[model samples]
Target: MSSRTLPLLFINLGGEMLYILDQRLRAQNIPTDKAKKVMNDIITTMFNKKFLEELFKPQELYSKKALRTVFDRLAHASIMRLNQASMDKLYDLMTMAFKYQVLLCPRPKDLLLVSFNHMDAIKDFVRDAPSILNQVDETYRQLIEMYTALSGGEFQLIRQTLLVFFQDMHIRVSIFLKDKVQNSNGRFVLPTSGPVPCGTQIPGMIRMFSCTGEEVRRLQFPSGGGYTGALREGSFQMFGERVIKLGTNMYSVSRPVETHMSGTAKNSAQHRPAHQQC
Candidate 1:
């Protein structure tokens, strides 16, 4: 597995957690000040210099159990608390949402854009809190320095590593189902056609190059299914548009976050000792 996988996994999952928490806080009518505090505290803990230093280190990805413990700690870093059932549902939603994003990435390098989208939203969450914003900005710099220059092959490895981590996860999320992006069986439905990834043209014409690198001939064929031109590539710097929306918040007042407990998780819980159940 690529050592680069952990940062992307951690950042995107943290992003999803924030989206759900923000929506829930609003839905429950938590006071504005308190809601802001909860978000600030969690973001502060998430991007703490020491924690981030460790997180960005090249190392093996943590097992699901270990990673869940980390998020549990992060989630509780604020005064707000979640009971076991709520936390389980939150984790399922976070994991499945991110899994769908990873599965649908148009190009390996676009993963950076996804991460940037999360970072952008995180900054917005604390835009008025200069201190917290500073921490997030520092991490953003680190992300650019570390990932922007990596070759395509490196990004491919990172993408594959993430897929391996998400393998066998089939938690059903209501939002995805409603959006028609996920099937009843908990697997995502990949679209057959869409705008091609940035920096590539839609597939149809093939140009044959000669040994001297001259284009000898061009052949055009039928390319099916509503494909279109690529959108402009997203900015990779600290403050700019992240054109891709995969890692942005999906939940809002209208679209409340909800999940269905998968039979796999339910069966596993039934087998586990009561004390071990979450």
Candidate 2:
């Protein structure tokens, strides 16, 4: 294999170490036929370094001598790169660590590096124009479902994964929104005291906040009602509105009103607050 391929191979191997061995790796720049050859070379390098010795060492006695020896050896070569076999072993160890909450092994940076490397293929796959939109949409849908599932099932790992997932999605959405906004002439204004005509496309700023569970309530006044005057008061009321829960903590919709009034009283008050007060 060409020397140029070695870096990519290492990256791919490191990615595999992160426990994200998905089909996306097939989309990498390296041709499918050469992946195994590159992986084998990496494996050979890891094996020569005796990296697997510590992993295989006996833990039955847990003596200070054994612990000190292991620590000394690790201190000497703590940051060695892995070959395919070692990477596979690392993956197994990580899974077990997460499953059993084992003591510190790999650092968080190591795990994050592996995750980014593994995602390289997915990034490349979605970069293609034909699949970009579909991939982005599907990713968002998957995130929502994953969030709901993790929240309901109390899966800690899934919850942690969702945190990463949402963070990545937020970056993607920011990029997408910037591009969309730059191409359009209009600006986003948070709706105040009026009905948005049906079919009004929601802006990205609103959508981003909505996805993160921010409550957006729209209030409308009757025809011949004061617009600008009511708007100033309505804006204040918006801040105090109670968020209405729709279904089981998964969905919610809020309606803003003055704190003292019921929905009907609030609606009526909006039209004739002075008369009601009188």
Candidate 3:
């Protein structure tokens, strides 16, 4: 078999379509000399069908309008026993198709938001077993990075998603810490300071939660938007101050005011005293 026939091994490995094509070719009693030509044609047709299915599949997240022409070219190239040059072109087309899909049918923000809402779930998994949390944090971080790359660093949405995701994660981490401490008989207490180790912003928080941090940093904030580091720090300080003031006011007003009433019965005595003086 020639080096070119190596790819055909994939056909032998349960490609029913190729089997049917082989059977049809044999039925025609074609000469051995023409069999390669016939097989090549059959492979081309099969590849075209596969490409079409891939392009038009119901779950295909890309926009058909943006990718139809590219798909057509790729399908045709795959069918024609194209050379490596053509195959490389087909790969480029696939890349473009993926990009167009991302641009045209951007994923719903809710998909990410929902994940954030389950931050506690991730934390619980970690708390039950540190390995579980580690795995989840790694997986979630990768997903965040993938989504950010796909969105080309438009991070406002990504940041919003992360915030919600982390908030849920924080609640879960707190729960996990409480559970661990309670179950450990005074043997374990989560660390109280320093950067969290599991993608969590708070200690005992999963630090791997924001895998897209690098991508997020690359994101350009809107015009007039200041550095994210400064903004986040300033916002946090402002929020803390507000909370402190609110707490103080609440404490001062929490108690009820006291009042007293007294009765005086000296009116007649006072009049007698005044008359004696007169």
Number of the top TM-score candidate: 1
Name the runs in model 3 displaced over 4 angstroms: 1-107, 152-278
Error of 2 at 87 (Å): 6.9
Clash count (model 1, backbone only): 0
Tens digits of per-residue lDDT, candidate 3, 1-278, equal 11111111111111222222233334444443343343343334433444533422223133334433443342332112333443344333233222221222222322233233233222332344454345445444533543424342343343333333223211112222334631233222433332222222321212232565643223323332221211121111101221111001111222221111111111222222221210
Those runs of model 2 whose alpha carbons end farther than 4 Å from true positions after fitting are 1-87, 93-121, 124-126, 129-137, 148-278
Query: Cα RMSDs of all predictions?
Result: 6.9, 28.0, 36.6
**CA shift at 13, candidate 2, in angstroms?**
13
Please, what's the RMSD in Å of model 3? Answer: 36.6
Worst 10 residues of 2 by lDDT: 242-251
- TM-score winner, 1 or 3: 1
TM-score versus the correct structure, for each prediction: 0.89, 0.19, 0.18
Ranking by lDDT: 1, 3, 2
Quote the RMSD, in angstroms, for model 2: 28.0
**Residue 230 CA displacement from its true place in model 3, Å:** 23
lDDT of 1: 0.84
